[model samples]
Target: MTRIPELLAPAGDAAALDAAIRSGADAVYLGASLFSARSQAANFAAPQLGQAIDKAHLHGLSVYLALNTLIAQDEMETALQIAGRAAERGVDAIILQDAGLAAELHRYLPDLPLHASTQMTVTDRAGLNMAARLGFSRVILARELTIKEIEGVTAEAKRHHLETEVFVHGALCMSVSGQCLLSSLNGGRSGNRGACAQPCRLPWTLDAAQKDPFPWLSPCDQSLLDGIPDLTRIGVRSLKIEGRMRSADYVGQVVAVYREALDRLQDNNPLNRQERDRARERLLLAFNRGGRFSDRPISGQMGRAFLAGSYSGSYGLFLGTVLKSDPVTGVLTIRSDKASNRTVTRGDVLSVRMSGEDKERASAPVGKISQTSDGWRVQGFHPDVLRTITPGLQVYQMGSQ
Candidate 1:
């Protein structure tokens, strides 16, 4: 049987790398400590880089280090140093944005394969050919291309002896891949090299720009959950999931969904329509850019902690415990009897684990709260998950039914 297209996931840090690998990513893409475009990520330092590579390789998954940033004259030496360390660490591939660097690495580290990061804007046959000439074994195509364009590019890539990968799901930039200058221009942050402030997530008044003055220009996050089979059928070599900035729960949920989708499609059949529909619902619930498409949350809304530095562990529904409600304050105080993965919140939707006759999961919204000397009491949306909680065992949210 032909091998299924690889499922690629992003790792902003070491923990996230472990999360992706455990959650079923065939490979994980990350950055070297210094030169990665995502300067904000607590990227793998030089010493830690070897450990990450070993872990991924131990699991039989590939590690691709991102050297995918434009290097100014001053940054060249440092960038090459990072590349050399990654190569010595036994990384499977190096992703680069610059052709010069690609050629340089190819000459110096002849054994290492090069992948053209999307920052190179490899969206068309011409670009693909250019990458091949520069010795890129694979080209991570731009995210904005439609399926037809992808098919065309894939065909051309194959003809040119190059492999093709496309972003199947993730947050999308407002501008074309590798083409956005908004961050560097507006905030002195260079988005091309990964210090994006994510200006797109902010609600902007177009009239303020004196250009197009409508909310209509706001681009929605691109979701190809429903489009996976079409992509697989086109012979794409890999499916990329974007979220170096997302949590483990988000990683697990998305990867599990896509993993199931890919499994169903390997029979040369289209993905089960129902699975895609279900996956879409799950993706929305898992936290995304929400809009007519999915809405990616903006800064200042969800603690914005991610904007400052990377936090690897799960949050929100990750942890919680059974608690008595403070009827007056609407807060659920944890009961000594039960603990949670993280903390229980008012709007949190959770599923209860159950035996026969129940769907095995139920969700509730925190409504009323009354704190007591013994513990906390709280109201719920449905109360099914909360009601089923046993006394001594802490009832936390179940991942999926």
Candidate 2:
């Protein structure tokens, strides 16, 4: 019998929690109002946390509270108190990055399951051994590990009676997991402490006189939906999707696709070519960088293609470039490229991108959409966005309602 791994989804808020459950996640991870890595996310407070846990438990979904930020000496006591509250609220587990806090929490609540965050940078046998010794029940392997490396680590993990979790999908950091100081150096915010300003997503240039800047530090988002079979075969206990800061629609869409894939895998019926292509399209519709997906660590590529310098941030399926715009009526005629298969309808979100620009010019929901002889005729944009519309600007579907 094949051991099916748990499908873990991110729950940044109540809406995301609902999406994760509705989309068929086995477990969901979220953070409290304090000491969470994603401080920008609308995290739950004490009362809200309890309610969220109850709601998830009702659906047979386990909730893991992310106290995964680096705890300073002065903040240790407060962090422990938060852990105690979460434990009392019946959280399935607590994810942590600080070894000191993990040790203290283990001592404080001996039975509470502790998961080592990917921020812990545990990639090899030695790291697994150390994690086991520190009383972590499971370890989230660093995102930098290849599939082969993951298999080796999982094999070693079983020897130490520790379950292993791998990030099957989501954004990939340019630096090593748990070791990035670039955000802190550039700004006062620290990635380790979870207040990352995402400075890497910003543009930079090697040449001082260069007109266009590139996002050299940002890598394409990882999608290992195709690699589920290999991960299951290697005895990975959990498959994680990383997007706590994304919208509920994105979470629901991504989770639904991965859930279907996992279900097929469990039943020994893998997705056919057409089904796989459709799934990839749905994932792309939810969110994508450079209008493509990549298993960067698995492929072991660090070149320009992998870096995706030209296209930064979450730009969904690339529809085409603007051929004409009517600023007064908020109508735009677009000439689509290779995205002929995708259809834009009412309520779908569209992002406008200018040539040689990293950031989006404008994003608006589609009020009306129609296929034209020349191209796509889209309308329902706000008056202000009309000014930004121009010929040759790229357009992408950020999400579909």
Candidate 3:
């Protein structure tokens, strides 16, 4: 009998926590107010952490606390204190990156399960062995591994009795998980310390003649929805979605889609083509880079196509190209493609993007939308916002509400 992999979701705040529970996450990973990799997120305080854990437990969900940042010598005691509090609150596990901290937690709180964070850069059998020696109960494999590599590692992990976790969806860093220093080198913020400024998402240029600033360091968001069957077959313990800085809506929608997929897999009813297409569309509507979801196979090598050089941030659902624009009237005539079958209605939030532009364009709610024989005529954006629009540009649905 194949064991279904656990569907893990991310919760950055109370709303996201509720969203995860309502959307049906088997488990949730969240951070405290301090010492989290996503320090910028509205992390929970000690009281809030206790409440969140209680709420999740009521829903039959496990909560894992993230203490996965590099702890300085002086911060070691405080970090241990945080871990102790979480353990007392009945956190299912604690994820860690610092080996020294892991040793301390093992010695002091011997019963608390420790998960080796991907930030620990564990990839091979040797790393798995090291994690076991350090008293870790689980090891999150690095994101750079191909499916074959993951299979090999999972087999070896069983020998050490260490469960394995893999990232199934969300952002992928250009550099390896734990080794990135570009943020600290270029800016004062250190990714290891959980304060990345995301300088890689910014546009850069190699040639002065180039007109467009390209996000060469940014990779497309990972969507392994299609790979769930394979992962389950290989006995992966958990499938994690990576977004703590994203909105509650994003967390809910993405979790719902993955939840359905996992249920289908467990029931042995794999998604057919049309079902897969609809799932892909729902995911795109929730959030996406301006690229195909799951651009590369889980087993294939990541190449140039994996890079999201064209756009770095979420553009939502791609509507169509602008055939004509009237900046003064704030109307756009668009040739609908991917969103042709979907209905466009009033109050829908829409965004426009021009080729070679790196920054997000001004978005506005639609006051009017009418389908034409050839395309759609959308109206009611602020003229000031429309002034940036032009023909031959792309449009996207940022939100329906």
Candidate 4:
């Protein structure tokens, strides 16, 4: 029997950690107060980091400390101290990006398990071997590699007794990991140091040749649920989900979906497309960047249309275009487009993204639902939004559902 790869989720905070554990994560990776790539997230402080590790251990889930940021010479001692603290708390592994820091860690704590971060730019079998040689037990592969590339690298890695993990789901960067200078040169915040400003997510106007503004850089979030079986067969050890800044609700929903998908893969029954479709629907409704999901780079078609530039921000799921509306009666008729069968319950929130500009014109919760002679009416467009809803606007559910 093929070994099932671990479902590794990100936990930005305590709540996110709880969600991952309860939603069925096999292991989780998180950052402490400092030396983390996602420094902007609500990272755990020293005390909180220890508490989180203990909490995760209580649930019988392993916690990997993310010391995965570029460390300066002066900060080396502080980083080591944090690593020492992480070791004291019994962290399963320490994910590191800096070679100097890894060397220091190896010198101080020779027995500690180290996993090279994706930020380390480990792409090929040689990079994997370097990590293994440097005393790293596992290596988180770079996100931009093709499936074929990953297969070759993993094969070589396992021969050297190195574990291989890859980002199976979550946000995709436009540039190569740790090599992006847009955030650093453009904003003084280095992505390699974990303080990325996410300038790529913002809309941009094309050069003078074409004066059109679009998010020409933003890549769609990754969803490898369907490819889990294939990847595991190829000797992948872990499937990572990348949303440390997400809400607990989002964390729980995504973890549950992937966990079930993994279970189905390990089962005797054949893969069910309909069941997977339903799971994806729930995933999209819960949280997604462009209101839709996409697979990783595939053969012959990998180069085309991976970017979600038209709308730079999260658009949830595209509900439909506005058929008609009345600002006076507080009712708007909309025929669902993306998923016609999708309905808006009382708790559900929706938004309409103005086409071509990457902006939201009208967004609010569904106050009431009614059917009339004219059409099916959705009530509760904010008072300010009614003036903007003229007609022919695309509707998408707001994320954090």
What tens-digit string does per-residue lDDT give for candidate 3 at 1-401?
34689999999999999999999999999999888999999999999999999999999999999999989999999999999999998999999999999999999999999999998888898899799999999999987788888899999999999999999888878788746899998888999888998878888887999887778887778898888888888889999999999889999999999999888877878788789888888888777776555535465865777776666567677678888878766678888875447767888788888766755566778889898977789897777776677777877777666
Q: In candidate 4, what are the lDDT values of residues 1-401, reduced to their tens digit?
A: 34688999999998999999999999999998898989989999989999999999999898999998889999999999999988998999999999999999988999899999988878886797789778998999988777888898889898889989988778888888656899988889988888998888876777777776667777777787677777888989999999998888888999999988887777745358888787888877766666566676622146535776566556577777788778887777876664446656775777876665467877778889875444357888865567678688877766433
Clashes of 1: 31
Q: Against the true structure, what is every candidate's RMSD?
A: 10.4, 2.4, 2.4, 2.2
Global local distance difference test of model 2? 0.88
Q: Using TM-score as the measure, name the better of candidate 1 and candidate 4.
A: 4
Instruction: Give per-model TM-scores.
Output: 0.74, 0.92, 0.92, 0.93
TM-score, prediction 3:
0.92
Residue-level lDDT tens digits of model 2 in 1-401 = 35589999999999999999999999999999999999899999999999999999999999999999999999999999999998998999999999999999999899999999999999898899889988999999998898899999999999999999999988878888856898999988899888998878888887889887777777778899888889999999999999999989889999999999988887888898889989998998888887788887876765666665566567687788898888877788888776456777889888898776767888888888899865688897787777778888888887765
Worst 10 residues of 3 by lDDT: 290-299
- Across 1-401, the per-residue lDDT of candidate 1 in tens digits comes to 34579999888888788788777889999987776877787888888889999999999999999888787878777777788888888999998997778888888888899999888888787898799888899999876676778888999999989999988777667677856788788778888777886665443464655653222223444457766766777899999988877776677777887887777676656556665665666665565431123322211122232121111112112233444433344334445333321333455544333322112343455555455555545566343434445433333332332
Lowest lDDT sum, 10 consecutive residues, model 1, at 307-316
Model 4 has a clash total of: 1
Cα lDDT, all candidates: 0.68, 0.88, 0.86, 0.82
* Model 4: residues with Cα > 4 Å off, grouped in runs: 298-300, 354-357, 371-376, 399-401
Task: State in Å the error of residue 347, model 3.
Answer: 3.7
